[model samples]
Target: VEISQILLHQCQQEGDETADVGPGGDYRARNKLLEHLITGDETWLHLSTAETKPESVTWKRRSSPVTKKFKVQKSATK
Candidate 1:
């Protein structure tokens, strides 16, 4: 599928990058690349918790129904 092809392309690109700094290659470029490169593992985390339906209730007059605004909590990515 598309995912597999994308992963394959990434692997090939990684191989090419390594080859650039491998034996008989430009070691200086390797150092420069390493200095500027940033790497980290992909992680998903909940930065905030969303309120439940009951927790999202709003106080209003008996004869007047009021609208409740809900807060949306999104996940953090790296």
Candidate 2:
């Protein structure tokens, strides 16, 4: 499934209380919850409790050239 779908599902599973942090609250809390979910940890996801508008959630996967080269070099070295 897509990351957004997984995230939204996770939020729903955790319940509305955790997903309903009002705007302007601590986004870092939400980010932390998302991080745990993405990283496959067992932490709870919490929504921000501020009065600001909710931020759009998005996800992207990035690969590192150094890691890619390292993998290739390790195979060559082997």
Candidate 3:
């Protein structure tokens, strides 16, 4: 399976910035985040580390991506 899509990387760099600048900087960031929240701003970007090829996500209910193979086996009595 292949997944090709641009994902919006929604993350606040506030924590890291705050760590470097201290509590005062964090308060401003907090305020900024709050303002965005109130105004519904889209502060998203694509991560440089984003993978173009996504790994297949198999569920716990069905461990493998080969679901049809298992389905046929389970319904073999038919």
- Per-candidate TM-scores read 0.35, 0.23, 0.15
lDDT by residue for model 1 (19-55), tens: 2455677553333334454768887776777678999
Q: In candidate 1, which residue ranges exceed 4 Å CA deviation?
A: 1-29, 32-38, 70-78
Worst 10 residues of 2 by lDDT: 69-78
Best by TM-score: 1
Off by over 4 Å in 2: 17-78
Highest lDDT scorer: 1
- What RMSD value applies to candidate 3? 19.5
**Error in Å for residue 76 of model 2:** 31
- Per-residue lDDT tens digits of candidate 3, residues 1-78? 121121112233333233234666643333333334533456555433323435434455555455452222222221
lDDT of each: 0.62, 0.48, 0.36
lDDT of 2 at 40: 43
Q: Score candidate 1 by lDDT.
A: 0.62
Candidate 3 accuracy as TM-score: 0.15
Top-down TM-score ranking: 1, 2, 3
Ranking by lDDT: 1, 2, 3
